[model samples]
Structure formats: C-alpha cells, structure tokens
Target: MVGFEMNDRRKIGIGLTGFGVLFTFLGIIFFFDKGLLAMGNILFVAGVMLTIGMKSTVSFFLKPRNYKGSILFGAGFCLVIFGWAVVGMIIEAYGFILLFSGFWPTVVVFLYRVPVLGRLLQQPFLMSFFDRFTRTERRVPV
Candidate 1:
C-alpha cells in the first residue's frame, strides 16, 4: 500500500522477495542441465542482490555495524564474490553493472565533495543546490 512504497525497507523487501522468486524460477528453468550453467550463475547473482535488499530488517532491528553485523556484512560480501564470479562467466557487463550498483551508494557523501575541473565550480557563492550539498538538511517527521 501507500506506506510500503513510502518506506525504503518495505520497498527493498518486496523488491528482494519478488526478484528472489523470479531468479529461483529462472534457475529452475535450467535445472540439472549442465549446458545452462550460465543461467544458474545469473540466478545466484540475483539471489545475492535479493538477499542484500532484504537485510534492512536485521540491520534496523539489531543496530547494524555491531559484531554480528560485521559477520553478516562479511557473508554478504562473500556472496557478492561468489555470485560475481558466476555472473562474470555469463555476462561480464551485466555483472559489473550489478556489482557497481551494489557499491555505488558508498561514494555518495564524498561524491559531492569532489572538485570540478573549472575554477567557477570552486566558488560556493554561485553554487546551485546540487553543487553545494554541504549545507543540506532534512526535516523528517518524528
């Protein structure tokens, strides 16, 4: 409903569960077929993405970044490595895109701090909202 779409956790959970089922189905399509190893690899990669997407529940409930959280993160990373290796054997470009998608957000904060080529970009006086994210603040409802 409206609430699920409004919240990121629900969005990701639904997306993950939906995609997980899809990939499982896709994996089944080539069940027991040695020739379809490529499809199986794709399924494995999709499963990991799905798993990561659904991890918000644990992270939110237990306070992520704790010891157990570190272990969970390691597991996720290992899944990424295993899945990526499988995916790379099938479609290298798609694998890279998926890998980058998994990691792209980590750079968001620092991304806004990168210096531009032109001297004009260095001046904050004429900076736009997107270019000057340093002063940005949110007023979330409690």
Candidate 2:
C-alpha cells in the first residue's frame, strides 16, 4: 500500500515537472505574449508545489508558527496586484524568503531524509538557524 502511494507521488511529480518544462518552453517561444508568459509563470509555481508534494507544501503554510509569514506573502501579492512592477517583485522575493524561513524546520527534516544530500543537513550552523523557529518559549503564571 505504501509502495503504491510512493509510486503515485513519483508519477505526479514527474508529470508536473514535465508540464512545467513545457509551459516554460511555450513561454519562451511566446515571449511577446504577456498572457502566455503569465500563465507559464503560474504553471511553474504549480509544478514546484506538486513536485514538493502538495501535502507537505500546504502544511508548511498551515503551521501556526508560520502564520506571520503569510503577512509578508500577502503584502507582496498586494504590491503585485497594485502593479508596482520591479518593486513588487523585490517585495515578493523577500516575502518568499520569510515564508521559507518560517517553515525551515520542515524543509530541514525533508532534506535530512534524502540519501546523498542528507549528510549536509547535519551541519551545526544550519541546524541552529532552522532550530530557532522550532523553539517555543514558556511563560510562568503569576
């Protein structure tokens, strides 16, 4: 049963990656077409979400500690919606960085489980940085 699930996930990831590549190609070919380019970007983001496994990706955003990350993300979206051009892109990049930081623990766990690359996940500095988010402070009752 688990094997079947893993196989399904792999198939989905491959399909999404292929579709993303196709969209990217079409975007390049139709560079003059703004609509197509935008669609390609959307598809590329979708592809990444799928490749990372939707459950894990969604969970990252849904985590309580990561809620603040949404504020930056939303601000970025608003900037883009207002058509701020380059400024919006810059803000969006920062937003993504914050969002990723908020969920770095999940990312670390995933990376640590990988084969060859897993060894790199053991670095003290990296663990310490990511662990900052995983820590919770306790308050004493008066």
Candidate 3:
C-alpha cells in the first residue's frame, strides 16, 4: 500500500529506536555536561515520541484507513501498542532481567513476519504443538 501517510510509520520508528533513548539517558546521567545532559535528555525523549509518529506514518502505507486492509493494520497497531505497554510495565515492576525477558518476545512478534511459512505454521494442530513446545512464549507468529 503506497497511500499510507500515518500509523505504521509511527510503529517502525518507535520499534527501531527505543534502546537509543536508553543510551542517551545513560549518557546524560553519566557523562554529558549538566546543561548538555538536560538537552540530551529532552532530545532523547522527543526522539521516542517522533519514532511513534514515524510508525503511524509508515503504517498508513501498509494499511490505508479507507481500504479493507486497514482493519488488520489497525488491529496490528493496537496489539503492538498493548504488547509494548505490558512489556514496559513488567520491566518497570521488576528489573533489567525481567525487562530483557519481556522485551525480546514483543520485538520478535512485531518484527518476525515469515509470510507463507507463518501461515503454514498457523494450522491448528501445528499451533498447539508449537504452543507446548514454545511454552506459550508468544501469540503472533508462534
């Protein structure tokens, strides 16, 4: 879809740069000069928000609101946001160990789209088999 001007772009941006914020924040807290640190912190957070905006922008191409594909795109958007929020919450409540544990799964579910292989693997029997094998690790492509 080429008409997209919003939505998925926001997601792509958000998905790609979250860790950058971590680095920027750490830099500000540890090494940057005080005034520079404050600016860096603000820039880092702004980058976070802009990344989301980019996701929404790019997603529009993948799922134009006026088209039928929009339904799936919108659903994907909701799920992506929800999954990340839950992951972030888990990390906040726990610590880095839990953070990494929670984070990678979401990252994979969002990024790993194997097309034909994914559909074939989605069969009911195959799904259950992998569900048990994978330990209910994820719902997206599992």
Candidate 4:
C-alpha cells in the first residue's frame, strides 16, 4: 500500500514541475530563445528541488556517480545563459537522459496505472518496448 501521498507541498511541487515543463516546451518551440530557455531551466531545477527537497536535490547533483551528468547539465545551463541555446539544449538533453535514466521504470509503471492510456500501453509491442525500461533488476531505491 506504500505510495506517494498528495501532500500540500508535493502538490505545489508538482504544479511547479508541470509549469517548468510547459515553459521549457514553449521555449524550445520558439526557436530556442535564450531568455525563455534560461527561465525554463531555472524553473525546472527549482521545481525538482521543491519536489524532492533541497537536501535530496543537492545530494543528487553532488553525488560522485552523477558527476558527468551533473557537470554536463550545469555547463548546459551556463551555455543557455550565455546565449548558446541550441548547443546548450543538446548537452542538457544528454545530461537529462543520463541523470534520469533511473526514473524511466517508475514513469513506465505510473503510465500503466492510467485509465485509457494504461490499456494502450499494455499491448504486446508497447509492452515489449516498455519492459526494457522497466527491468526487474534495475528498480529505483525507495
């Protein structure tokens, strides 16, 4: 029965994260505007901090195992701020994939719990594709 509880702070965190994503998408769609991209990056990082707590966020970025991703992500943020939006985005995308590789399974599981989309994701082809991401041996630590 253990799961995420919908507390006020978490709710606010989710909202911030959603807004961050929306802004980032809009920024990208607008041909990589530096200001928008910088704002989006700020919001996204803030949202993640709020969502996971300041201590956890710091630890996540500071973890020795995450050095490459953290460095790349930070560099990318700097690049965006310095007006290299396209290159920054490319690096950030790579960093993001590396940093969040562990979360893919949880995302897949969450997707499977949705109503209509759950059914679609349960199909053979989709399941096969998703199963690779949701491996039994690679579970995220609770």
Number of backbone collisions per candidate? 0, 0, 20, 0
How many backbone overlaps does candidate 3 show? 20
- Per-residue CA lDDT of model 3 for 9-97, tens digit only, reads 45654544555455435644664334333333345335545654556535543443324433433343333234433333233224323
**Candidate 1 residues 53-81, lDDT tens each?**
44643453245334443444344334434
- Greater-TM-score candidate between 1 and 3: 3
Question: Predictions ranked by TM-score, top down?
Answer: 4, 2, 3, 1
lDDT of 1: 0.42
Model 3 quality (TM-score): 0.28
Ranking by lDDT: 4, 2, 3, 1
**How does model 3 fare in lDDT?**
0.45
lDDT: which candidate is best?
4
Question: For candidate 4, lDDT tens digit of each residue in 27-84?
Answer: 8999998888888898888888877789989999999989999999999989998999
Over 4 Å off in model 2, which ranges? 1-40, 48-85, 97-102, 136-142
- The 0-to-1 C-alpha lDDT of every candidate, in the order given, reads 0.42, 0.58, 0.45, 0.87
- Candidate 2 lands at a TM-score of 0.43
Off by over 4 Å in 3: 1-32, 54-104, 108-135, 138-142
Q: Taking the tens digit of each residue's C-alpha lDDT, what string does model 2 give over 84-137?
A: 434544565676787776456556666766898877755887667755654542
How much is the lDDT of residue 63 in candidate 2?
Answer: 78
